[model samples]
Target: MVVTHRGAQAVGRCLEFGCGTGHLTRALVDRLSIADLALNDLVGDCEPHVMARLPAGQRARFHAGPVERLDPEGTFDLIASASVVQWIPDHRCLLRDLSNRLEPGGWIALSGFGQDQFGELQALGSSASAPGYRNAGDWAAMVPQGMALMATRQIQTRMYFPTVRAVLRHLRETGVNGNAQGGWSRARLQKFEQDYDAQFGTAQGLPLTYDAVWMLARKI
Candidate 1:
């Protein structure tokens, strides 16, 4: 999405927050010629893993900390995060901070889950939802004054699993349900399975929905 707005040209400097395992980082490296790169993630251990995926001799620095605490030395041409901002509680403050860190005409591209993300799990009484989930229309209002909204996109999709247990395992393995509480007894697990099957079972299998929202803004 960032490449779509900034074109196929080179970016002078780029900053990417929540660059888990360098998925988006690798994508950006592949799609854009970023002269200098700064990567941030809350997990310090991920630094080696993210660095391993970068191109040989890539000019990059890894900042190990929550983005809120990061005090980067200079501005960036593109500040991007993928599936990360939803973990933040204050969207307004984060947006304003990131906007302030951008060079004029720089782009800020972010993607997060919408309010309906994991709707079936929420309906089944799961408290694993992220605090910053907002609908598609709500994102435009979150943009700071100096940034111009260039584009926004929202997608609703689902992945089917064989059973309720499988669905829960998928969430856990993917680290999306990190906040889920434990202590489910055999009876409780059985009841949850029955309820989920009755409520969301399809001819294919049990369904888990993902509501993804993406936004692009450029500093004026």
Candidate 2:
């Protein structure tokens, strides 16, 4: 969710999709004095936090829903997203829609995890009978045929923890461990933690690896 590049520095409207808890949105509002700033997320509860973080008198609007449901009135100069797009079931249609909505020469900056992200956790999930994880190559293939790719990079980050309990706590606070289908049973939870520890825990502790992909492109 870092701003890897700053283009022309022009004053125009900017939109951020999937601005979770306004972390990146606040950064953009502080850095760019644009005519308008729009923030959108699938949930509505983020409005108050986003409002508080924005500077006084900045033109701001919040949209709460799936991206396809958003009916933006006009084209935007820049459309950015981070750590969010991978969850959508139909990313291709979403990207095509974004391309259609962007003005000519407008930029799209997106960052998300690849298949290698949380490989150990994924292995554990697979062992438990869950499936369907996408990698960076899967996302690239979903991009429409004509979009011009400006840049792409994948970085690996490994977080070492003192114990498996600490790792699980981090995931819980981050809301990264929830199952979309339903809640887990007590026995299932115990088994999952035990399996994870048995397979990946080291004498030093546990190591969690995240393979993140950052991409920038133009609508053309």
Candidate 3:
């Protein structure tokens, strides 16, 4: 969607924050004409995984650290991230910072979760949500100065699990294990499983929701 929106012009430089496992990096490199690509992630070990995803000779610079503290040289023609903005505590500030790094006419594309991301977990009083969960309307209001909000979209999808234990395992493997504090005694675990099943189970399985929001903006 973002590539289509930005048209077919080649980008001079592109920066992708939260390039976890290079999912978005591979997609962008495959579809966009980018002269330079920079990838950033909080985990230093993720560098190799992202690097390996690139085509044999395609070059990219990897920056390992919190993107908020990253100070890459020069401005970029595009700044993009996928499913990451929600982890930011102050997305408005990050938006302003990202906008400042954009060359005039540069574009920013981001996808994150809305307030209902983990609906089932949230309903069960889980603290598995990231800090900056904003809906489409909320994201529009977050556009910083010198930038225009071009588009925003929201999508909701549900994944079914065979059991509540499976749901918890899914969360752990997907890096959303914030709800897995150490206080879960065996009895408490059993009670939680029972309650979750009673409240949200279906003939197929238990449902977990993912509410994703996408935003695109351009520097004025």
Candidate 4:
């Protein structure tokens, strides 16, 4: 989605939120001719890692903290985030603030999870997931009047695990369900395995769903 929707666009200047080791940062440099690029993340160390991957001549700036705490102080040609906004608790106003940082004809590209993300875990009463979960239309509705939602889509992906234990391990490692941690008694563990198998089991394996939402909007 990033490559297709955001990669080909013209970018005079760009700002990235949640750069986190430069996954999207790498994509931006690989695809856009950014006159100047700014990468941001709470961890102060992301700058070096991202810069190491870009060409030597790419003009760049780095801000190392929550975006709200540090302002880059200029409108941008593009503002982008990938699989990051789901971590934010107030996505409506947060997105509005991000849109406000764009030039009139600039673009905003983002990917987050839908409300149905991790349905099985949600059914099991885990609060480990992100609080701000909205679908494509919900995002469109929240977009400010001056912006236009040029494209949006949500996809539901299921990942299967060979065993319920493996499923729990995956969540812990990925921090998908930070609340999934526990020292279950043998019986408690057994019960959880049984219930999960009975409810969502398949011949292939146990399934965990990812409801990915991707959008590309323009500040008209």
lDDT of each: 0.90, 0.73, 0.89, 0.82
Q: What is the lDDT of residue 105 in candidate 4?
A: 81
Error of 3 at 150 (Å): 0.7
Stretches of candidate 4 above 4 Å error? 1-9, 176-187
In order of appearance, the predictions have TM-scores of: 0.97, 0.85, 0.96, 0.89
Q: Write the per-residue lDDT of candidate 2 for residues 1-220, one digit (tens) a residue.
A: 2244545476487889888788878777776677888889888998888778887898989999977889878988788887876666677787788888788877777877777767777677633111333564565676776677777778888898887567767766775434422456788878877887788888767888877877777766
Writing each residue's lDDT as its tens digit, candidate 1 over 1-220 gives: 6766669899999999999898999999999998999999999999999999999888999999999989889999999999998889899899999999999999999999898999998899877688899777888889999999899999999999999888878878888667764677899889989998999999999999999999999999
lDDT of 4 at 27: 78
Q: Which candidate, 1 or 3, would have the higher TM-score against the true structure?
A: 1
- Give the poorly placed runs of model 3, Cα more than 4 Å off: 177-182
After superposition on all C-alphas, the RMSD of every candidate to the true structure, in Å, is: 1.0, 3.0, 1.2, 2.3
Candidate with better TM-score, 2 vs 3: 3
Off by over 4 Å in 2: 1-8, 126-134, 137-139, 180-187
Better of 2 and 3 by lDDT: 3
Model 4, position 136, has a per-residue lDDT of 83
Q: Which ten residues in a row have the lowest lDDT in candidate 2?
A: 126-135
